[model samples]
Target: MSENNCIQYINCHCYMTIQSLQIKARMFSRISLISLIMIPVIWSQDWQVQYSSMMKCALKGSNTHLSGSYKHPNHLTMIKTFWIVNPVKGEETINLVDHPDYKGRVQYSQNKDGIFFLSLSNVTHKDEGMYCLRIVAKEDKYLFFPGIDLKVTELRVEIPEEAVEGKSSILFCKTTCHLSDKTNFTWFKNSKRLSESNVSDQLLLPSVSTDDTGNYSCAVTDHKHLSSPAVTLSVRYPPKSVSVSISPSEIVEGDSVTLICSSDSNPPALNFSWFKENQSSAVGCGQSFIISSFNSSHSGRYYCEAQNKYGSQRSASVSLTSAGDQKAVLYAAAAIGAMLICICIFIVVKKNIRKTGDAGGQSGVSKQEENNSTAVTDQTSAKPPKPADLNESVYASITHSRPREQQRDGDEDEVQYATVQHHRNTRNTTAEDGCQNGNSVSAGSNTEKADDSNVIYSSIKSS
Candidate 1:
């Protein structure tokens, strides 16, 4: 061949080879794309299944539905199965299907839309384990589907044994997992269904009494389980009827008194405290509290409280008063009695002096009395002045009486006259003979007689 023809032929041959290589690359790319579209993509066995953490089974029910979706292509047929593996038995697989080795039942179904559904029936705790689904196609190899961890939860509830009256009580009804779906929680009291509210953690009792106390329980069901643990509700609080009594109903100031606080309640009393109205500090405690000396400070409305673990109860108030008025009355009575005694003593002494003529006539007489008596009795013998006129004569005698020293000197002679005058006055006699002698002579005679008699009496008594 010519040199130019040879070069053109080589170039044409190289171009044909390049075109063949391009066609082959396109064919390989088409095949790879077809394979990618047709082959079932096996998800990792670590695929996660979305479900509630808590799975509960009824005692008599046959099936618990579990739902999930395969992550692979829709054309792939997924086969799901559940295995009850005993970890204690060296991971021994216990078939949960219609197999005789299984103690529970497990069934599965795939919808036309490729959604997978599973049912576990008569399941126990041993039936709970890791579940896996395998997917395969007519033209491709088998691939592992997602895995679901199954947990069997039991119902549980807790409540306090007792709650205080008029207080809020928490009734706990919780599931092993938070129920995200529709759930119903019901409370029962003594077998009667209680009205339940949503989103409330406490059973608020605005005011509770004895009638509100009873056995209580809670049941939580999420279209799955029912009947939780039962709890006893005991409402305890301070006594209802409280009263206080004072030892002396009538309290008096300066007198010691005791106040008693009493009430009826459960959970025996812890303390008894007394308080006065509007006072911040408590007075005392115990059934009886003593006031050393009741005073105005102690007076006022007083009340007491009986307290216990449950709560405190208050007693009715008792009024206290001071005894100042009553004491004053008693003091006045005492003063009157003393004054009467003094008056009586004065009267007795005065009468005795007049009867015995103890007062010396000279010193006992007044000057005005002596002047009047002298004027009236001048015409008379002045024979110690008749007693009927003694009133006047006594005045004269008083007027003529001597000084204390002179009277002492004349007392010996005047004593008899004074006695005669006293006797005449007692007899109410006006005759001058009543006295019989002149005043001085009579006085001397009576004075000697009186001295002799006194001496005789003294001698006899001593003997």
Candidate 2:
């Protein structure tokens, strides 16, 4: 009776066990699927503060706004909310508004949308750091780690230490943080727009020159109002526009003269040399060249050379004349005038002389040259003038002798005299000097003569 019952029971029990195993496996699969879906929902609902931007680049000296939204378990009530920087004080939540560094510069605000905001004015380099939001609740306080990385920066112009003409140089527009690669830069020089290229953060100068010297600044294209301070850029160059200046416009012999050298360059040309035209050597070296006593030696075309570390330049020449040259011209004129005066005097004296015919009074005649003859004809038959008459007459006399080769020691010398010019007929009148060897006076005739007076006689020296 027990064997049939035992076998049936064992068969029913094995079937039941197999059915239970399949149902349990199905239930376990359902539970795992539910857990996988529910875990993310629970994690998403955990206490978390998320900012609008994970990283921000704010312009210095400008105001910036940062917003954050938070979610937590509904059972917890928020008691306070605040902002702070990294290296936070764990025990003391330092109030940003009360911080000496942030006082008067930080503001806290909230909106009906449950969005919390932090407004910072007059941002500065000191404000650059990681920022976090703290939510204080009745049961606990929460801080979101790996918070906002804020960068407060301004444009800055960085140039090569030495800027030289005719050389390449690069100027950088820099910021505290690296901006987006697509960000464009603007440049200004002397308060005017300098570069038109907007893709590069650097200004490239293929060749530097004095024209590039000026106050330079840079800015981001989007934040033009947040530009950097102007920096002076000096481009060095050699001396140029060299020129010479004279103190006195007029120059003369024995007068002092000064020559000045000047030029245009990045650095002033300190070394100056003066040279004369057609001369290779320098006459002097200095900004000024002085000739204490001007003379012919100093009269010439002069120029100056200005030199600096970069290069040298020569100035246009200026010419000068000595007064001695003027004096020489004056002397030549005086000599020519004297010679003309002597010639005029000799012509007058020769015209006044009368030529007597011979020593013997045989129809004695005075031979004389004439343009218009004023000669008195000799009257051989007329009586001679009285000695008293001769004494009152104006007359001049000169001694004439033959050439030394023909003259004997005892030979009589001929005497020529100039008589007063008058309208009259008169015999030969011979006036003899002490050297005349007994020349006879004219015993010849004389006609009634007009008063012989007021005749201007000129002297003729023997040639």
Candidate 3:
């Protein structure tokens, strides 16, 4: 009995396999039959009491049944039968029904064919023992040697001593006795089922974190109400989701400033570090850093690191500035704006100047025209223009006083001629383009030729 589990026995520290235990169940016993009113041991053939099994295991808080069959000689009448536990070889003991320890928890059934069954309900660790059957016939008794061994076990949620975050760990639902491979195990967390038969032996927890902390328990599938005692699952590591906040969001020169770091972790993070945007090393270390008087040297983006026994994490960066630096930035922006405005105004003024120069050239041309008109007025003649046709006829009449006798000869018909100064016609030229020329027509109705003494008359008309 050394190859199997044996924690159920109080004195025995070893266990035997089912095959070996069954062989052991058939131990030698002195069983005899006797007639009524004649108490004497009568040798008889060996009795046959066969059990379904000799070694049995069950989960705590569950029930187990032990069944067996018996055969005896035809001459004896069966009186009574019962079951006992951890009994002496020949000494009589209390049956399971009357035993103080098994009150209200034991049941027995027997058929007329000499077969019987023993049922143990709500089995517990204290109930672990060797059980045997007894039969009484005509005041003589017999003890069935060897017996069934019963063991009770429960599930446990087992974990490693140092479970860490972001790491894998296997948690076992264990029992001291090995149940059949077909037996199913159930896992629970805070009264909620996590898995069934598929993950009965162990639960694989990956990337453990603080959020995974909780109470865990397990039970055999059929004995679900008898779940194992709750075991707490805790995960530990460095800080996470680290972040920094700057008090008084707007920074000003000579103003006090504070940077505070925060994170989520188990057992709390105790170390912290502050760093500038481009610097390779930390500027300070603690939960918070304070600057009594801000300046340009501290005006840069910064972040912090949070650390614990497990590891460390860095926070998001923030920026800081002084009042003087802010004002300088504003001044430079204003100067650029003013310079752009001036350039735009200059371009507009240049365009207007070009337009004025073009208009002035047109006015100058009009003034030159006025000057030409005035010159023409100064030299214009006061007479209208004469007809310009050369074919127009000029007629003249002349008279001559004849001597006494020549008068009688008709000399009065002598021809007369006169000179004419011609003027241009207005129909063709307005006095030589809008002004009269100095030349004029000067002929009188009765004019004397400079070479003739007698007066002559002439007139000109366009035909």
RMSD list, candidates in order: 25.5, 21.0, 23.6
Could you tell me every candidate's TM-score relative to the true structure? 0.39, 0.53, 0.56
Which scores higher on lDDT, 1 or 2? Answer: 2
Off by over 4 Å in 2: 1-57, 67-80, 86-90, 94-117, 149-151, 180-182, 324-463
lDDT scores for all predictions?
A: 0.57, 0.73, 0.72
lDDT of 1 by residue, 171-219 (tens): 6765554443544666667877676454332355556667777766556
Instruction: Output the TM-score of candidate 1.
Output: 0.39
In angstroms, what RMSD does candidate 3 have relative to the true structure?
23.6
Which scores greater on TM-score, model 1 or model 2?
Answer: 2
| Rank by TM-score (best first) | 3, 2, 1
Top candidate, metric lDDT = 2
Per-model tally of clashing residue pairs: 11, 3, 2
Best by TM-score: 3
Give lDDT tens digits, candidate 3, residues 147-194.
677888887889878679889877888888877788777888899998
True lDDT of residue 118, candidate 2:
92
